[model samples]
Target: MIIGIVGGILQGMEAVYLCKHAGYTSLVIDKNPKAPAMYLADRSETCDVLKEPERAKQIFSECDAVLPAVEDLEVLEFLDSAMKEVGKPFLFDLESYRTSCSKEKSNELMARLGTPIPQPWPECGFPIIVKPSSQSGSIGVSAVKNEEQRLRALEKVAKLNDTPIQQEFVSGKSVSIEVIGNGKTAKAYVTTEVVLDSNYDCKQVVCSSNILPEKDDKEFVEIGKALGEGIGLKALMDVEAIYTKKGLRVLEIDARIPSQTPACICAATGINLLEELVCSKLGKESGKVRKDGCAIYEHYVIRGSALYTCGEKEFSHVEAPEYIKDFWGADEAITDFKTGKYEWRATVIFTGKDYQDAVHKKKQFIKNAMDNCELEEYIDRTPEMV
Candidate 1:
């Protein structure tokens, strides 16, 4: 099967993982030739999706299914129509994407449905978060502790050409849930604990039964299903929130192929969101299969030289060692041979019954790999690393 993935950046990488596990070849399209996922795809093309959507559709027509991994409104709007025009399975919930793209609208809708979202501040007051209503990840996001910071944050949001949303900063652990829908109904299949590094980027995702407090699990799943149904979701989406003293409050939702959580879900629970969406699109019943285990997805890369890496020097430095059970979104480095600089992007998933068990396995695996390897802390260097 040829799955056409319509982005090649960091966010788009997740779709590639899903495609690979489903035993399908990926036809990756990205404007940047050096996009990380392009290195991992079976085939790739460089094109400005927003500018030349017709060209993109023509290429996508050759594929069995299409996955629009981009967040740009124009590109998404194009895919919504193009998918129908090409008569191919497009794994995108444009309705949910429409709702998710606007925090202001989605929040209001969720409120009507009695969903637990961060209340608007002035009502909730400071240490509130001032962020862009349309942006994802941490783009133009600020935690304002005082009136001065709030004013600055609002200004930053406006300057960035995004709507300003003042949200009560819920202090607690963060977790995310990935759901699949077909516009009429949805299911929250899996959840993962979001482990952010010091820089606030997701470091590793831990998928296990302990992802949410036992009490919050039902509520979390119900909220996720309701949110997707509320937005009239048509495909895969991610619901992110913080677990506070009370429970999980809906922070945000992204109705696209999410980057980290899907791999974690697949690695641990054996539930592949991409596979489910694709199968559903093909009108096939995706037999539910799962396992009880905690899984940790981590990557390694050194900035210095290629000789220290195991893969072919010309491509992404990846090695399928016996110790490494699975690989997802590993990209070969695009090198300027004259310069010593290179990046080896690879992810290894470690599984066990608990967090410590998974951590111990990861520690041992990394320790063994670190000796003959020049590994460094993985950092987010995507041009659009939001």
Candidate 2:
């Protein structure tokens, strides 16, 4: 069997490895040649999935399935259309996938479905969060404090050249819930809570994360299940929910695997999301996901620095999921009680004898990492209390 893996980020790499482990040869395509997943693929092609969908399809004529690992709504739409034309397992049903991919559509669907959501208006609160409806990676996201701030956010949205969604900011501890589904039945992995450094705002720079069960697991599970069914979504989903006065409310839903997937959720729970996704695509109901005993914490040692490269080309780095293996410059070594050009970000996974041991390990990891790194200025959001 041959599977086509889309996008070339951390999730893409993991997805390829999972497919290979499940006895399938994988072919990868990405716009960037340096994508880490490209290095691990059975065959790599240098073609834009969005710009050259026809060419991408030609390269994967032998593919039995197509899986997306990046956050490109346009590319997903194109792939969905192309897959239907060729008669292959597209995984996501067209309409449901689109609904989850768009912020505006997802918000409207949630409201119509009677799921609790923050009012989608900046006027509801100062320092509200405004971001593109179909974007990821904190790009074009801002905190609007007032009318002036709202205007600034609009300009930023225009600069991004995409329609943006304004969400009322909810201040509290933030957590990401990982869920796996086949668009009907679903199972949720451990809920991972993230705490930011004192200098770095929790809403801005995501500093550290750990696997901890939610106080209101039932509520979150109900909402997440409803969300997937409402949109006919399948595969991996991460919903960012915050605890507020009313209840635990969802900030946003990522239809794809999250950027923090490799570190926090996987570290805490032994559940391998990529493997489950591959199984689902094959229509094999093996009950493959497991979370019997797992404990993990992931932290990134962050530092502020100006651009240190000489070129007009785009530059990106791929770390070892959630560990410090090495640096771009071989001479630089990460040290304790030290801040250099690089930060010591790592994901520590250790099985616990009991539940208490898991929680204790998470807290200990945070304390140790915090002692080594210092936080500078963060994108702080001062939302007025409602």
Candidate 3:
């Protein structure tokens, strides 16, 4: 069957990869002609997803399903409406998509449903995480330390043209929940703890280091699965949570496959999200999947902007193998190439003896890689005392 895929950036590329991997033909559309996913797609159309619904519908008419790979909520919402009009295959109920797309609304829903969530406030809280409920890549997310900081942050975020939610910033270990949803049911694929590279914000996300299977928190997984099932999630979903003194509080619930999720889940477990997504769309039962050992996905954050000076010693040349594998003939990679504003992008997927060791190894790789590379202009943002 053919899948009509939308968006064509990094996340879009990943979605296309998954669809092709599942043996499905793909029709990809994006505004950028140089979108990475276009490289391997069966067919492509360069258009703005928001203004080209008719064009998208024409493309969707030839496909079995229309799937959105990007985190653009407006486009997804439009697609949802169009899917209803055409009576085509889409995973979730439109209402569920609406609820999940809004961070503020999702928090309200989950909280009312008895899911643990951090206290949310539109205002009146310091050290708050100011995030646009719909944006991704942590685009506008900021930690405000005081009232003055909150006012300044709000003013800055106001220019973004989206309503922002301010909530208490919980500092502790961060984890991600990956789930695949059939229209009626969703199963938790795996839970992984993520450590942001030291230069995480600069590179956007250099790489994800460790995927510690949450065998210890099966109940939490069950709860999240119920949450997805309750919401009628039909596609891939990712819930990011932070472990705080209060407990496990969900930070964000994305109704689409997360960026780098393949490296996080598929690399850790044998379950491929793309296959599961196809199965879900076809109403097939997803088999039981579990994580083995510990898997890591690490990437490097080269300099992006020339706002800050780069250290000459920061950039070094090292010979790293192009690929590494965990199973027989199962190709996994430590790094990949992307010609963005940065110099290099790599991710290493490997299992460790335990969580700590897994994290240690991942950090070691980042440190070593950074040590060898020369930092060019560092992005100048607000520097704080850590």
Tell me model 2's lDDT, rounded to 2 decimals.
0.59
- Cα RMSD to native, each candidate? 5.3, 7.4, 6.6
Clashing pairs in 2: 127-144, 127-145, 322-347
State the C-alpha lDDT per candidate: 0.73, 0.59, 0.62
Clashes of 3: 19
Q: Give the TM-score comparing model 3 with the true structure, all chains together.
A: 0.73
lDDT of 2 at 173: 69
Query: lDDT by residue for model 3 over 91-147, one digit each (tens)?
Result: 445566677778878988787778877777654365677777766656677787887
Scored by lDDT, the top model is 1
In what order do the candidates fall by TM-score, top score first?
1, 3, 2
Give the per-residue lDDT of model 2 (tens digit) for 329-366: 11111122234545322223433544466556545544
After TM-score superposition, the amount by which residue 51's alpha carbon in candidate 2 deviates from its true location, in angstroms, is 6.3
Candidate 1 — which residues are off by over 4 angstroms? 50-54, 301-343, 374-386
- Quote the RMSD, in angstroms, for model 2: 7.4
